[model samples]
Target: MVAAAILASAPATAALSADGGVAQPARPFQFTVIGHPFRATSDENLLRRSITEANQDKPAFIVATGIKAQTEACSDRLYAQRRDILDGSPRPLVLLPAGSDWAGCRNSAGRSNAIERLNRVREVFYPDNQSLGVRRITLTRLSANVKFRSYAENAYWEQGGVLFATLNIPDNNNHYLPEAGRNSEYEDRLVANRAWLHRLFLMAQRRNMEGLVLFTDGDIKAHVDEGFSLLSGFSAKQDGYAAVRKQVRAFAEKYQGKVLLVDSQGEPKATPAITWRGNLGRLGVGGEWETVRVQPGTASLFSLKDADSP
Candidate 1:
């Protein structure tokens, strides 16, 4: 069956109370997250199989983190092919960009072509406010704001009383360059991401959401230093994720609902795990596809399940 038909037949999350004057808490809902599936250029089959498997499970939607593998050439043809594959998915599929998708890109002349490649990627994948799949969902892109008009990839939507958003933080050290005066791309994106995060948090708060879920290519907490750096005295290696980490911590402190950050860069493991720090939680999907079941009104708002688990 097509994704739309399947989704239509799925159980509803919210229902009216016995009095018919108030609504009961939303029931649990599942969504699939496909980690970096393509390890090489020839791994297209792997991606196809992942999508097929995800469809069988019939999650509300599917989020594929990263389009192409590091080994894949940063070519327009490849990007187009991958976009077509995602568009074929029966489920609503959201694509998140990874460092491999464009950060390391180079022109034939051996000069950095990262910015151009990233723009091309955006044009190919984010053609509209809807996801790339047979079944679609409307998204609120950061580009809606005039100041951040170029960031269509950063978007958010509400599902099952939860706020779901995507931040374009690539895995290669957040795509930070050590060289001075050459970080226009990284710096600009950081600013836009901060603004997007603030907006997402404010919206969730205003709407009294059960929780806020963020999807990104890199783990924001992976390289963050919580304590003083002893090696370089008070100074530390330039960590691109520092700002985001700090912002998340501050926001989570005041927010009454749980905050979950999901990323694709983790070590390969049989089962994925979520580590919690107070109200903030982090889940790394690694190199395998995983599904998260979000249960409202539970002590743990979210739980991880293998994609193929029955």
Candidate 2:
């Protein structure tokens, strides 16, 4: 099923309450996703304006997949600057790290340390159990208990009968350290991420969430506009990437509800937003699988209202 089919399956708005009063289930609300915002003097104005607009729009929340520095390599200063940008938002904000932010900066001129930079990101952006921005929501983090507990960046929260989650799944094959001895750290995170993901599905099931949204910095879907291939770096053989995608497909199929897989960075498969709104094509997934493309200045707006509603 494509987006149209999913829309077609939606139940129409119910009429007035048993009495004459209006019977309202919660109103459909929207949130914003800002992909990679590579900051520079030229982009300062645009970034500020986008935040202002999002604040005015008053989304239930806002999330930035990651922030990138124009020419400068990743550094603590850059991460702090990005944090300030996120904190400036008047609405709740959740920031997830992208490859450019850390993993890809391993050999930068700034003597960047991927691990330390990531730690700073979690420090400044995720200082508390609550989210950033003026309006905050407490999120369940995977770091609360575990050996790799500092990775509090993987977070989840529920809104409007939907469970939303963010994973630190960046590009570069999820930092799959292929070196013989350097693989331990990568392996640890892989295990932790999977556990968090499984827990998310379990919680969503227990809560009877109407839908689930999984957001990451990398495009995890199997197919792109050109057709499915391994070059996208999300091939079935890639360690962390493929495992998460398989798990997502399984849960989406079992839930039989809307499941939106959003990736911040990538050449969009369909459109900048709502890439391919249809069934999880090859996996035979049961839910309405929608892929949204969210990048700086391009925000997807959705409303819960029926187009033909009175």
Candidate 3:
């Protein structure tokens, strides 16, 4: 079955609820979101095993972040195959792109050009202007909320009462402003991307998402640092990246309790009453880093471990 055919199977429902509401109550929702399955060339079956492992629990939703559908060489085929598996599964699947998967960087080989590679990726992933080009194979589209194609780098949608928005922050796969030239155009584009990111956040806030889930496949505070140096070494897009940092901090500050960052291999930082180490590696994807602050009406949900695992 083709990707679109799979999603076209779901029939729309129309009904009224208590107080004459159209939307129904959301059931308990859960899913595993995996990152950077970069076609897993050298890792020798990392994609199959890690993905199979993460799906072990059979959660209601399975989100595969950063699946590059760009290259006919690597992820292109894999992305299609992943759709087949998820379509066959008993749950809904969503794909969000990260740095490498978005075709924003140079190839695994340093020789490949960025714009050309990204063009290829754009061709495969967002083909047909993100309207008719979703690589979905034999899946049904949900009426209330569903995405037909992989959303362009930064994408937003709500599932089961949870509002999820993804922002694109690619390494350009080591591709930056022409090393020495520091072209102003590239910087301008970077600035534009950052603005789009802040706008996405605003959209999320407007949605009044009770549970805001932010997914990124980069190193967030890769190591532990206690100060603004948490954002050090970001010299090229220092201003741009710093702008992103400020927005992230603002989110953390405003919704200090509801925000959750899901990083696959990252060890989260320590904050006063707001740090929790994840045990997702226990299930897979190392799970997530939940805030430590204990606020009213919030569950003291603790699944993360601290630095000391023993």
Best-fitting candidate, measured by lDDT? Answer: 1
Question: TM-score, each model?
Answer: 0.87, 0.75, 0.58
lDDT of 3 by residue, 1-310 (tens): 0000000011134335678877543454445565455433434244455455655555445555554433434445654654444334344445545555534445566654555544444455443312111232222112112231322545555654455555445534222443566444345445654555565456555754445555655434412232444334655244334445555655545542245555443332322122323211111132221221112122334233242225
Q: Quick one: best TM-score, which candidate?
A: 1
Candidate 2, residue 121: lDDT: 71
Q: On a 0 to 1 TM-score scale, where does candidate 2 land against the true structure?
A: 0.75
- Once model 1 is optimally superposed onto the true structure by TM-score, how far is the C-alpha of residue 48 displaced, in angstroms? 0.7
Clashes of each: 0, 3, 16
- Residue 282 lDDT in candidate 1: 79
Which model, 1 or 3, shows the larger TM-score? 1
Candidate 3: lDDT over CA atoms? 0.42
Better of 1 and 3 by lDDT: 1
Off by over 4 Å in 1: 1-20, 39-42, 222-225, 228-237, 304-310
* Pairs that clash in candidate 2: 1-278, 2-278, 3-277
lDDT to native, each model: 0.78, 0.61, 0.42
**Model 1 steric clash total:** 0
